[model samples]
Target chain A: MEKRFLAIGWVLSVLLLMGSLSGCGNIEPWVKPYERDRLADPIMALDGDPVSTSYLQHVYEAREGARGGEGAAGGGCGCN
Target chain B: MAAKARPVAAAAATSGRGLTMMLRYGLGLLALLMAFSTARASVLPEDRADVLYHLYTGGGVDIDGPSILVRKQVGKSVSVVGNYYVDMVSSASIDVITTASPYTEERTQWSLGMDYLRGNTTLRVGYTSSEESDYDADTYNFSVSQDMFGGLTTLTLSYALGDDLVRKADDPTFQRDLDKQNYGIGLTQILTKNLIATLNFETGTDEGYLNNPYRSVRYFNPSDTSGRGYSFEGELYPNTRTSNAVGVRARYFLPYRAAIEGEYRFFTDTWDIDSHTASITYIHPWRDYTFTGKFRYHDQTGAHFYSDLFPSAQATNFRGRDKELSELTSYTFRLKASYAFLNESQSWGFLKKGSVTASVDWLFVDYHEFSDLTANALIGEEPLYSLDAAVFQLFFSFWY
Candidate 1:
């Protein structure tokens, strides 16, 4: 079982590596820098408060059976 | 290595030692490592500080603590961050009440991290340690993030390793070790002038003693003298489990200067636990105050070996009664308000802005199989267990 898990991890890691290797160069920003004012607004900030967010995520993890894959966080127990 | 089940009451007390802090949140700052890293090919994180008070009450348990975080840039290319957190728990929980005396315990954690940026790439390294009377854990992690496609997209790859030692309070020589590993990939994209999105995928594995020695599975014992028809035995769990999760989120700016976001995630593990979670949030700024509301929903299947009551002892190779492993559905509703007291116009020295925010979350859960033993009902006629919890967060943050 352990060997099988390691194999799954390695295979996915390789696929992710391949996907990341296919980037760089120009993909023109459809929305110019100047047009991103709304996107840059504080309200639109994806993760504005790191401490608060991390604490809440930890609480959810402790109580739920699920963990990880939610925003660099864990089990998506959805107690967000 | 697989462990032999052993009976003990101390495990119920150690239940609050904290199982989640070992992971160290690789997701919280991935965006800050990328989208926020734009413009300057080598931009370190911003300097900031936060002090917070958090409280959770429910399930006959009370956990309240203080968390302090500080981040400062050491130079043009490097930034450092540190955190000190504590959890003071008073638990008279269902498990504790059933088999042992109520207990009070404290868990403290410390974390330090550094980020180095060169060109359009950022490298991060971190360490975290958590300690309690019967449990101790340490984790180390590293990650690299790149700004691709003219800063329109960001990709972050990360890995973490954890080592944990669990000890039985009543048995001086009884101890166990658990090892864990996590792998993650995150992508952030600027979808449009008014929209942004992130997709994160994480996989992990755990090995060694995975069950609580202080926790037990209940089984019918016809000859038991106790009026209750059931008896308890130590829980037995598989020695290894692998899990996978994928989550995606999107935030969009409303035409009226408000923001709305939606998130969805799917999770599955070798233990046969599958879960789906979704949430929606709305943020609105009025004058100096930002008001936000969120609703979240989650549903999951029980682990393969989870059973509230077994027909007899050793009914299965692995038996567990932990409610968290039971099929359940949960909902959370939150309301938050943040007031900005300082901004560019009212800056204080090196502090460019400051805000104090408070939020309250109401949580409710309905268990499909786990029964509430506190009711003291007859066998097989017990009421389904449910939980209600309230979480409160109050904090002040300053950014330079």
Candidate 2:
């Protein structure tokens, strides 16, 4: 299982590197000021409600064995 | 009709004037340039406050709480944030009923953070502390983010450390300590005018006592002279654990004022547990209101030393009966709606850009290897355990 995980990690790293390189090109045009209204909307934010997301993360962490990659570290609880 | 025609003719005559047209075009260009310049400059966060209420119900456990968070811009390039949270939990689960009596507890948490911005880089640091009757924890975190490619790309790195103290409520002197550390990296890119993507990787390590002090493991007694019997013993677990996770998220906006988002995550740990998660969300905006629907699926493999029952003759140094360590799968569905009640142009007294949001989620979980101890079946013949849970939240936010 460790070997398999290492193989997957390598593959993902390669793919991400390739994508970043390709993205460095000038193939896409810049968005205009008038066209930014939609992007500036609150719904377009990565985390619109920080308080609610924090609660969700806490519940999941207590119930599941896996954690991290979402946000900052938080206080621990004795739910289990 | 005559008045409209006269106005149209006058506009046509004005267009025929070349100098007037040139002056108008030049002024328009200047205004556009000014807008662009202002958009490129760094902007400070507005002073805002959020009040949230949350409720959770499942598997004979109930939790309800309220949280408040406030952010204030201290200066041109500095911001401060503070949070206070509380959780009131009441539990009467099968485990508690069989081993101990039902109980109610209250947990409180406090956090403070600061952010500093300079040029294209931002630095953030935070501290959090939580206290309950039998547990106390403190965590410190720091992160830095840098923007590149003319604000098209962002890279972030973060680290956190936690110190926790766990104690048995009945045994006053019985206390244990644990330490946790985490490291993470993230990258975000604007793939196109209507698409954005992010990739994140995190690794965490835990050392010292990591198991609940009150949990017990069931063992079959073979040497019983009268009949086959069962004995319960305290659970034991390994002292060290390490885990890693990688995730990718993407969002794309449709042409008709709607957006779609997708996320996938892979997780693995030293305990031989592997898991996968996939989720998708759709968001639609109409006037000043936004509505969202989301679905998530998660599946995981059991740890190496987890079991429902163990033979009395076979004793191992590391044994666990926690259902969370067993093979399991879960599905969650969520619906959310938010409305912007006030805008900057129409402020409510001293507050601006007020919004209210409400969300609800339903979750179902099935355990593959763990049995329901509350079942009528004998010993190891108990039925599999499954659970249904619900979560609800309502929040109000305002900026000044």
Candidate 3:
């Protein structure tokens, strides 16, 4: 199983490296002042920077123990 | 790199324009030049990077491998970030296997992302892909954030689409795959100079097979044991889980360049799980650097269907399941520190501004069961157990 996993990882790494290199030449710096401001609007935070660590800890406990499916599903058990 | 070219286009100007029109054109040209010059002057630093690692020992064993991340600014409004992570886990904490042995699980994840800044707004887009020993996942995500009221208020929107595939250990015919989509919206308000509050909502939808081939539940009827006994097989959960959270944090600056921050989170999911977490950090500045310490606490409860025992096989409602119901609870603690130095500077003997940080964290897990399922055929009924683990992380970031 370990050998198989290593083989798969090596193949995928090669593929990803090739793909990234191919895009290097075409990767343009897209900068639009108005659009950039629109993007920064606070309504969509990825994980809420300042308080994210504690929040993630809370969610992890919910999915593993006290909470059920009120949030996203877990990899195995959905117990809360 | 042919796709990297974006030339500034010249504006159309009338050859025989009025003096006012000519003056307006001249001012527009000057504004355009200023914007270009600002872009040229802003450069992304080459030395910014981060690393994180974690481990959990005791009843619920988890050992996360070393993970690394690096970020580089490519242009005025563009920066690129890359990351890689690996983790290996053991299954002895759950008490399912007969031996005191452990099953091995591994996962690898990587991603590349771009962040763009314009005035008071920032836009970020990225693609990440991950592969487990037997599962695969790929995600494409994008988000936009803006600062309002002179940085007092912030808002963001994000979306992601992903694909998941799960393969069972022994069953060739039992394969599960799902298409998943997630969306999030958040808002942060600065109630005062020292207080901040944030509210966020996230929703996800998944469609396809959802069943664990190696998991089971006990039977209610004694007759249903049939010696082959109480574990349910091949059942899938079809409900969607939605979550909403509200949080508040405050920071107070003290004398001698010291500050304290406290934060709390209230979260709930559709599966009936509600949780609360709180943490505090203290930062103190020394001669040329700062040191920080953190502490946190968390708690959670069990779902409605959790059960500790199964009935006799003769009972009519004999479901022969063991897992759909088990109570769970846990706690965690962490400590970390960082130091910075001046590696390169324009002036005197002060260290030239480069920083390196290293930290260590320890965690523990305790689990209990209420049923005879513990002493079942595959695994002898055993009491609760505790899992313990520790992790180390190191990182460096610099500005030129």
Per prediction, the TM-score for chain B is: 0.90, 0.87, 0.71
Better of 2 and 3 by DockQ: 2
What would the per-residue lDDT of candidate 1 be over residues B219-263, giving only the tens digit for each residue? 998787897989989899998878888999988899898999999
Candidate 3: tens digits of C-alpha lDDT, residues B96-146: 542134576776777778878765455778877777655667777776655
lDDT of 2 by residue, B172-220 (tens): 9989877777766677766666777788877777776777877777778
Model 2's interface RMSD: 17.3
CA RMSD, predictions in order: 7.3, 17.3, 17.6
Sorted by lDDT (best first), the order is 1, 2, 3
Worst window of 10 by summed lDDT in candidate 3 chain B: B1-10
Error of 2 at B175 (Å): 1.3
Point to the candidate with the largest TM-score. Answer: 1
- Sliding window of 10 residues with minimal summed lDDT for model 1 chain B: B8-17
* Candidate 3 lDDT over residue span A1-80, tens digit each: 85586557656655665554444334333332332332232112222121123223422432243221122110100000
Ranking by DockQ: 1, 2, 3
- Deviation in angstroms for B64 in model 2? 1.0
Highest lDDT: give the candidate number: 1
TM-score of each model, paired residue for residue = 0.87, 0.82, 0.64
Clashes of each: 6, 0, 65
> What would the C-alpha RMSD of candidate 2 be, to one decimal place?
17.3
Which candidate number maximizes DockQ? 1
The DockQ assigned to candidate 1 is: 0.31
